[model samples]
Target: MLAAQRRDLLLARLRQDQRVVAKDVAAELDVSEDTIRRDLRDLAAAGLCQRVYGGALPASPAVADYPTRRGVGVASKQRVAAAAAALIQPGTTVVVDGGTTALAVIQVLPTTLAATVVTHSPTVAAALAQHPAVEVYLLGGRLFKHSVVTCGAAAVEAAQAVNADVFLLGVTGVHPDAGLTTGDADEAAMKRALARRSADTYVLASAEKIGAASRFTVLPITAVAGIVTDAPADDDTVRRLTEADIPIIHA
Candidate 1:
């Protein structure tokens, strides 16, 4: 096929699957892997995809701002949040990440339950103000506006001090091969630090994040205790994670 035709077809596959492997696309199009690579590079230059080592991911994931993210996949996030909330018990000290989904976890938490909540997001800390039994600790640091969370040395040091029972982690992507990832380096560092301080870490992932990848690696998928998501066990991404013996809680 012509270069333009092949590129269009590749874009369509990426739209449907959210990713396109170069070798797979080459075979499907009856073309060479070099041709597929060129097509992907062109697509990336056109701002349609983000080129990865062996594939390309939809560009939206690479630059999804906080507000846009808060509005996408609402129901899926709610289900994930519900499952994550159930993991928390009374008197548990939880390290809640700052994000819309994490906020949903705060909303679903029983008011009667007492817990210590540590976080770097001022917004998350404020949301817990109405919880009469919860103690809130807001980590001080340089604020990162994209996700509206704190980062840098102060945040990392503060996270080290908190002895949390569990960390309700959020991420931009989760892949069996790529592990847990986020869009920014500082946020990844802060998340890693928090995970180290917690006894157990559970990632709250929406279906969109499953099988996806991002620029910065937060932690290996095995580093986390488990994943709480709404994806079915039969799904390809979920199956891969399960095969790796990574526990998945389907909501």
Candidate 2:
């Protein structure tokens, strides 16, 4: 098959099976594995797919800019947000991560619920301004515009001082094999730092993020308390996550 044909078939397989194994596709196409690997490399460079150890996985749309992502997964984000927001109890402290899904969470939190929220995102902190009962703690640092979250040594240092009952984490991708991932190195580091400070961390995974892969891994799938997602329960990704014993909280 031609290289263009390979790209189309590879992407199709990624959509259907959630991943494309290089050898498997090579055998099916009667082509050499090197050729398939080259195709995967080109696709990855174009941002059309995320290359993994063996082959490729679907690229997450969540890697887009903050404003663009706001319109990408609206309903699914709301579902997962509501589910994650439900985990916070009154008088408890929670760390809310930065992302569109995390932003949606602010809309679901009860205005009367008294709680403390620690965050590295100025966006999240500003949204909580109207909440009369909740106290917001903003972690200061260099702003990472892509996700609109604070990062760098200052943010990681601030995270160490926090002790939260729960952390509503967000990532660009949630896969059984690829684990939890995001697009930026600093954002991933910031996420890991916050997870350490919180007793439990639950990922806010909307439908679009499921089965996708990003450039940098934030944490292993098992590191999280549970995955809160609106993706179909029977989805191959979801099924594999269940098989791996990662808690799946259906939104």
Q: Per-residue lDDT of 1-251 in model 1, one digit per residue for the tens?
A: 88888888888887667678999888887888998998888988776776788989765353477888888889999999899999989889999998888988988888898889999888889989999999999999999999999999988988777899999999988877678888889999999999999999999898878877777889999999999999778777798889889999988
Provide the lDDT at 95 for model 1. 94
The alpha-carbon RMSD values of the candidates against the true structure, listed in the order shown, are 2.2, 0.9
Find the candidate with the highest lDDT and give its number.
2
Candidate 1's C-alpha runs over 4 A off are 12-19, 27-32, 45-48, 57-63
| Candidate-wise lDDT, in order | 0.86, 0.93
| Model 2 agreement with the true structure over 103-172: per-residue lDDT tens digits | 8999889989999999988989999999999999999999998889999999999888999999999999
Top TM-score prediction, candidate number: 2
- For model 2 the local lDDT of residue 161 reads 93
Candidate 1 pairs with clashing backbones: none
Relative to the true structure, candidate 1 reaches a TM of 0.91
Question: What value of lDDT does candidate 1 attain over all alpha carbons?
Answer: 0.86
Q: RMSD of candidate 1 to the true fold? A: 2.2
